[model samples]
Target: MKISKIKEYFSDEELEIRFKSSTNKRIRDRWHLLWLVQALNYFADDASISLGYSRSWGYYWIKQYNMKGPSVIVLPKTRNPEWLEKKVTDEMKIDLLDKLQKEPPEEIGGGLWSGPKVAHFIKVFYDLTISRNKGWNLLKECDYSITSVRPKHRKSSDEDKDHFKKKRAPKYC
Candidate 1:
């Protein structure tokens, strides 16, 4: 099939500079496609094949660049979704951080602070039912670490503890 040549929107030097400077691989590939067609006289099929892209992929970007100029190739940097940011306000985060610093109230099933506990607290106070993972993320943001202390038997006294330690003393001594 016959393919159309890419229109020169920017100079070959400019395309070369864009290809070199672009940090995103996808953007660099698009720039390379333009550079090959406009600067090196490579046909769309060969250029796409060399770049490990299909001819239609090359055609699509070329058509976009030809019509929309250089801006079409640039993608926005990734960030958290707008709704997520909106859902958890700065005030709420500050409050959560403050709550994590203290003992949990009895109203929210008093216990050591944990992912599920934090999630339950949010649900109780903020009316938001969040996942345990998200709750864990909140704990991390608050600089709270989770740890477990060794369980002790209520019946075991200091004498029993001493006897156990004596029995288990290192043989090296």
Candidate 2:
């Protein structure tokens, strides 16, 4: 079995004050555990159990206090950075809505706003050039829907399917 010890510096009154004044319950108990070991001469493990903390809790808290004071009782905290910056702001949504009502898609993209058009619009208006999927997501966020109306090409082509079927018929069948 290994033996653990806690270093004590503050008096009973100071320890009680720290225990009462601490906002974090865990830190307050740490203070009490240190006090119990130093003032009462109780073993570190026993004090930790009486304080309802882990075996390492008393050792770590005492180590921290020895290094600093009551200020270093709480453990360090860390947080992850944001995943993405919001491109479609509320203001941008309002601007898009206002412009959409003023002009039709044909006037906007000569018939439709394709992926490239979306990229251009995002660059020109919002000043943020996002991908086609991002632009589509932005439009969808604003409850806007897009539909294709069968764009016509300038090239001439015969639409007679029955004429091709008769000529291409096999002699065996």
Candidate 3:
């Protein structure tokens, strides 16, 4: 609507009353005052302050007030993507498994997966970036121990297979 038309609809007395009520000293928040000032601009006779504000800013305030009423001008909600919040995926676990299996146990650093090493490998090979903690989680999920323990030696007799019968016989007795 034209400024002249807005002024014709609401008299100067009405505008002053609304402005004073909206900009009450008791109200600590500036948002209400901002909305009132913007609304007043639509009908303001003086062209100085109206011309000072950017047209886009005025349009944005007008659009917001029309769509959501005055309260929406306070602040907008903030949110972060769930994927960025934490990394947990089956593909990451499989990638870790493949790397472990392809490399010899001795070749693998520390004879087990270390968080940073696994994270680096993922970034270098798969191009799937992840944090050290996430890599540790993947190892834990796969039941791979981080400790450095030598492979146990087995006796020839035990490998020959009568061990099951010998062990069961003792338990039965």
Candidate 4:
């Protein structure tokens, strides 16, 4: 298949500046691809081969350049405000910490402050639906750690525990 000539968008000097100034290897390679095709009169396949990239990659970028111009290679400067907004605020965190210190509210049932309970609390009070994992993360952020209590035998006596502690305990330094 015949490939059409790439349109001149930036001059050789400008392309060289772009290629040199680029911090990302991927973007620099794209600029280098353009330089090879436009300045050195290299075919897309030849440019791809010279740049150690696949032919399809070269064609894809070339097609993008032809359709969208030079700005396609540039990174977006603006961020989405909605994405940047915090779902949980400082006040909510304070409230969560206080809630965790006490028994769970009646709506969620009385028990330990688990991930599901935390999530349910957030859903009820804050009007937000957070994941169980995020709830655990919140617990961790508040400096709460996981705990497990050892089971006690029904027939075991305090005298037996004292005897084991006094005699059976390891004495290694």
Candidate 5:
């Protein structure tokens, strides 16, 4: 879409001031897009390219401005505060930590507390149903990690020691 020389809803000076002062990159980028068109007279494609957004985004933002007011340009931050705490509570965390400190799953004859195992454990003990990923995250939050004991020589080489093949007598003959 063509960017015409529309009369300033907001002055270039005002947009520039807000763009400079705003901490949010979205606000700054949006302001820059408007300023590029209204003040600098840049094309939509050029403005989007300059601001690292798709050309369609530039047109979208312009449409957003036309439909609403200037406030629509500044995107809101994605806020997710209670996602983890809602699934795994603090009490459950303490209990999980205590369990990890005592014996590993193998020692307890239960195998390793993998993601699924941790999920089942939470369901049974804490009475909370959690996904495998959430269970793994809970274990990570408790500072627990999967460990195993295996004896292997560090410098062992993966090569045949002898090249000759052993000959055996045929049983049928």
Candidate 6:
């Protein structure tokens, strides 16, 4: 119903009195509050000016109430039972760094320690299942570069490696 119609149905003083006298004061408990407000609005027919809440919000609340009942509107409880607040320890990080430094590039199958590889290594070695991006972030935080040192390949007298290298060079450069 329109705001004018709602105002005609009930006065502002009545709405204020109801809002103040509401037994539930937990603002976070949106479900109960929404139900209460909507019920009041329906009964009073003055939903538009009630608490200055938007008409769309009120409509959505009513719709949600119809679809899922009052209890569903309440925020679900989120308990971090197994969540690890602290990140990987300094000692563990140092150990990983030491291992990475000591191991040859060939040991990790050549190329740099990719994000996935680091995550896998951490999971296997330290029994930590961190995301690949998070692993990369840790490496970055430790000022470690994801680069590997490779020995320059020496060509035999018969091999023409220079020809391939020159051919692949950018013409514009």
Please report the candidate that would top TM-score against the real structure.
4
Residue lDDT tens for model 3, 33-151: 34344455443223223445444544554455456654544344233355464454667678678766654344335444677777767666566678988767666777777455666
Local distance difference test, per candidate? 0.82, 0.65, 0.51, 0.82, 0.74, 0.54
Model 3, residue 5: what's the lDDT? 24
> Candidate 5: what lDDT?
0.74
Query: Could you give candidate 1's per-residue lDDT for residues 40-120 as a string of tens digits?
Result: 988877888899999898888888888877878884334436545436667878998888778787988777898888888
Identify the runs in model 2 with alpha carbons over 4 angstroms from their true place. 1-8, 74-173
For residue 13, model 2's alpha carbon misses the true position, in angstroms, by 1.6
Poorly placed runs, candidate 1 (over 4 Å): 76-173
Off by over 4 Å in 3: 1-89, 102-111, 150-173
Give the per-residue lDDT of model 5 (tens digit) for 49-101: 88999999888777777677775777443343544454676777787877776
What's the lDDT for residue 71 in model 5? 59
**Decoy 2 TM-score against native:** 0.39
Candidate 4 global CA lDDT score: 0.82
Deviating ranges (above 4 Å) for candidate 5: 1-12, 23-26, 39-41, 56-75, 80-89, 98-112, 116-134, 146-173
What's the ranking of the predictions by TM-score, best on top?
Answer: 4, 5, 1, 6, 2, 3
Candidate 2 positional error at 152, Å: 35
Candidate 6 C-alpha lDDT tens digits along 37-115: 5444442123523645566655655455456654534433232335554368888788777766644245345456666
| 4 or 6, greater by lDDT | 4
* Clashing residue pairs, backbone N/CA/C < 3 A, model 5: none
Model 6 ranges with Cα > 4 A deviation: 1-79, 104-111, 146-173
Model 1: what TM-score?
A: 0.44
Error of 1 at 23 (Å): 1.1
